[model samples]
Target: MYLQTTIIAIIMVATFALASWKLKSPEISMVITAIVGALVGGFGFPSRLLVEGMFTYFDVGMIFLTASIFINIYSETGAMNALVRWIVKQFYDRKWLMLVLLGILMIIPGALTGAGSVSIFVVGGLVASVMSYMGFSKRRVAAFIYLFAMLAAVSPPINLWAMLMAAQANMPYVGFNVVLLVPIVIIALFTIVYTGTSKTPERKSKEHILSELPLPPEGMNWFKIITPFAVLLVLILLSKFAAFSIPVLGLPLTFVICAFASAMMDRKRWDVRKWFDVMVKTMDQVFPLLATVISVGALVNIMTATGVRGLLAITFITLPMVFIYITALLFAPFAQGALSYGSAIILGTPIIFLFNSVGLNVTVTAAALSLLFPLGDCLPPSRIVGRLTVETVGYEGSYMSFLKAIAIPWLFMGAIGLLMLIFPNQLDFLVVY
Candidate 1:
């Protein structure tokens, strides 16, 4: 059974490799892999199983999709622009504080949505513009955007890698807030400050900076901008503190509510038609992500049904501890590059289980592993976030140069992940569940 399942897993992986090579679509490649794996496992045309599997990440998909919608509406309403301008106006002279605030801004969307790509889309361009004015090279600007966006996705509340693994392991996705937040915050601050500083740090005049930024729409203010997020924060806090009294608005619904409030608060009111158009655009923007989530779910189910997951799990658990650590540090990102979030289920789940078996804290371990996953978003096969960052920042330098620019911070983030894995027990107290 082991040999057969191992071969089946190998074939499925080969199928994915071939399909991804030819198709250039991660979701399609994964779906094809699932179909092939099921057939090879002698469950030909297992329609019911395939369909059921697609729903595995349904909740996760909705969270990203809805959160993205809120982000889009917030951007559309000029709140995002006003907020960035406000930050620069207030703190551009403070250099380090401004960079930290900007880094935090870049982190917010991805943290809310659980995909770094969201951060790149919503704020990468704006942040890159600000960084450019600070006299950073184009490559460094792209690297900063890519790095914080990566950190944002790995941040708390919506870390897809950790959430995916937790769901698969039947672990409550609680107690991870502080465990994930601390290291990510540190890494983001360090990366931004490190990149922001140079031999001669150029501080653009405040007038020049404000002039470069897109003007906030007429009637746009911080109050308008702050209200929607305030609503979101209050709702989330209420749900946690007043669980029985409040209807449990899941993340998706909560985001939708925020999106609606954002639209309503718009100085330029969105007509129903405009809202519909925005929703449709949001769906179009998020379709690839949603598709990837569904395909990952299907692929995981197929692997489990064919016992491929078990085979891989057993193999990983039997490896030397040092080798396991090496794999987490090295392999996790590449797997993520190839398979996107599916890598978390395929690789992360097994590693988490293996660590848990040895008494490591699952929350810290998962958070550590998640840090590595985003690094892959900047690597090969499908360098989704990487490519987007380059395009967003208009980095005309060689891709290698961009990679080189981020190399230090990338390794720094990975080292932190490795340390977390090594001392998860020590860090376990950070878990606030």
Candidate 2:
């Protein structure tokens, strides 16, 4: 049975590669892989499994979709523009402080939404403009956008990779706030500093840069800009702190409420027609990621039903500790490169179970593993985040050059993830759940 399952798995991999190569769509590639796996496993077109699998992460997809809508609405209010302009006007001359502030700014969208693409979409272009004003090259701007956005996706509140693995392993997705927050902040800041200092280009005058930034629409103010996020924070806190007293709105509804609140703040810009347009635009932005999520669920369902998941888990559990470490470092990004979020279920859950069997703190291990997955967002086949970052930053450089630009921070982030995995117990104190 093990041998048969392994063969099926290999065939699935080959099919995924071929589909990805031919279709160039990770979502479709994964669906094709799932169908082929089912056929090889003798399931012969299991319609129920296919449908059930596709909906496995339906809640997650909703969170992403609603969050995208929320962000689009927020951006439509000119909040994002006002915020970026405020940052530049306030600290553009204080280079280090400005870099740090910008890093934190980039982190917020993805941290809230658990989709790095949101960060790239909502704030990336604005931040890229700021980076260019500092005389950084387009390649550097792209690297900065990708790296911070990646870390943002790894941050607390909505780390999708960690959340998915935890759900798969029957672990609650709590206690990750501190576990994810500390390391992500440190790494994000370091990435910002490292990338910001590379060129040290002559700083453009504040007046010139400010003039170049988009003028925030009339009626924009700090109160209008800050109110929506404040509402989001309050809702999230209420859900966590007063769970029993309040109805459970979940992240999706919370985002929906916040979207309405944000739209209310800028009524002049947000009529019903405007809201519909933003919804359509957001759906267009989110379709690829939503499709990837659905396809990953289907593929994982097929793997589990066919014993392929069990075979992989047993194989991982039996590997030497050192080899497991190597796999965490090496296979993670490659898998993610090919599979996108599918890597979380395909590899991350098994590794978490393996670590749990060995007395490692599963929360810490899961959190650590989340750090490694986004690095693959820029790699081949999918290159989802990388492609978005390049386009958002208008990077016309060679793809290889862009990859080379981010090499240092990428390795640095990977090293941090490996350390967290190796010393999960030591990091256990960070878990507050």
* Candidate with the greatest TM-score versus the true structure: 2
In terms of TM-score, how similar is model 1 to the real structure?
0.97
**C-alpha lDDT score of every prediction, in listed order:** 0.88, 0.89
- Give candidates' CA RMSD values in order: 1.4, 1.2
What's the TM-score of each model vs. the native?
A: 0.97, 0.98
Q: For model 1, what is the alpha-carbon lDDT of residue 117?
A: 85
The lDDT leader among the candidates is 2
Residues 1-433, model 1: lDDT tens digits? 8789988989998999999899888889999999999999999987988999999888999899999999889888988899999898888877788788889899889888988888888888999888888788886787789899898888877999999999988898899899888898788877977786654266577899898899978998778889999999999999899999988889999999998899888735788888888889888778878998999989988888999988989988898889977777679889998999999999999888899899989889888989888899877788999999999999998888889988988999999998998899999889997
lDDT of 2 at 405: 79
What total of clashing residue pairs does each candidate reach? 1, 0
The residue ranges of model 2 lying beyond 4 angstroms of the native Cα positions read none
- When summed lDDT is taken over every stretch of 10 residues in candidate 2, the lowest stretch is 194-203
**Model 1: lDDT of residue 238:** 96
